[model samples]
Target: MDEQQGRARRPGGRSARVRAAVHQAVTELVRERGYGNFAVGDIAARAGVADTSLYRRWGNLQALLSDVLLTRLNAQSPMPDTGSLAGDLRTHAANVAREVTGPDGLALVRLTLALSGEGQQGLQARDELLADRTRQLQAMLDRARGRGEDPPDVLEVLDHLLAPIYMRVLFGAGPLTPDYLDGLVDRLLA
Candidate 1:
């Protein structure tokens, strides 16, 4: 290929821009209209792309939503690997708190919840999302075990740590104070 063709094929080109725009549009629409209110055409208009592009790339709205949620989840919460499990748990908890409370946080959470009820496609996406998160948690727990630390099971961590944070966010309980987060980690570890 010529240099011009190679440059045209470079990473982070029009394809990346289109994907980013579409993801942002989905996030905004979910925040504004909630899930299931908008269709792929709406997303295309908002993202300045053709509806066919979205359909061709993602197959359907559920697939696109799944991609957006998964991308946001992966981008927002990276696993922490401090030497001690406590440190890792604390960091992970804090990262979750921040994401759930961030500008697009509520929308993503609502999208996840909504996806679970949409039908077979939604159900599959929801299951995939849950599995992805479970895998992340299990990896951290495995690391703790490898270091000779006794760690709780993945469900325990989800139930005791993440569930509470999500509940607070959903219910508008209060700010996720550092003390409260640390307390959750400490209690789980105890």
Candidate 2:
């Protein structure tokens, strides 16, 4: 509807502000106190929203955390397509490397690991996160195949590429140097 007809639009108005505030609060709290250390009221107080608003919107803290993690995941690591499978893999690995090494990245990784087995909600969140990642990888690999490139299986990519970067990040093994990232992709494609 048009504003001339007494109908107005509020794109990213109050709801968006509240959502952004809540997401920020969740991230900050996770960084400060870690997962399972804060309650719904704490989030509401930090976000300047009512507790009922959170419960009504997200049902529980676990659901809210899952949403935050998934949002961060999708926002950070977008799949790349660079004509060749090697280029695509290298670009994608670089994206992931940058994401995990970013300022909020370590806290996010800890949160994901912490949320893996708290309860039913935790399991569901992990499953959803993995499923989304799998879908993204599959889409990228399918694109490479369409280009007549022989791409490795998604699992192989995970093992040879993503898993190593994640392990390095999780354990502070070493810096994710470009040469190292390229090497992982090279090994996977080899």
| Model 1 lDDT per residue over 1-190, tens place | 2453354336689877787799889888987888989999999999999999888777778878877887778878888988889999999999999998988767556777788778888888778777877898899999999999999999999899999999999999999999999999999989
Output candidate 2 Cα RMSD. 4.9
55-174, model 2: which lDDT tens digit per residue? 877777777787778777777777887788898899999988898888876655676677775878777776767787789889989998998989999999988898899899988999
Off by over 4 Å in 1: 1-10
Candidate 2: deviation at residue 18, Å? Answer: 1.5
- Per-candidate Cα lDDT values, in order, are 0.86, 0.81
Model 2 scores a C-alpha lDDT of 0.81
TM-score computed on alpha carbons, candidate 1: 0.86
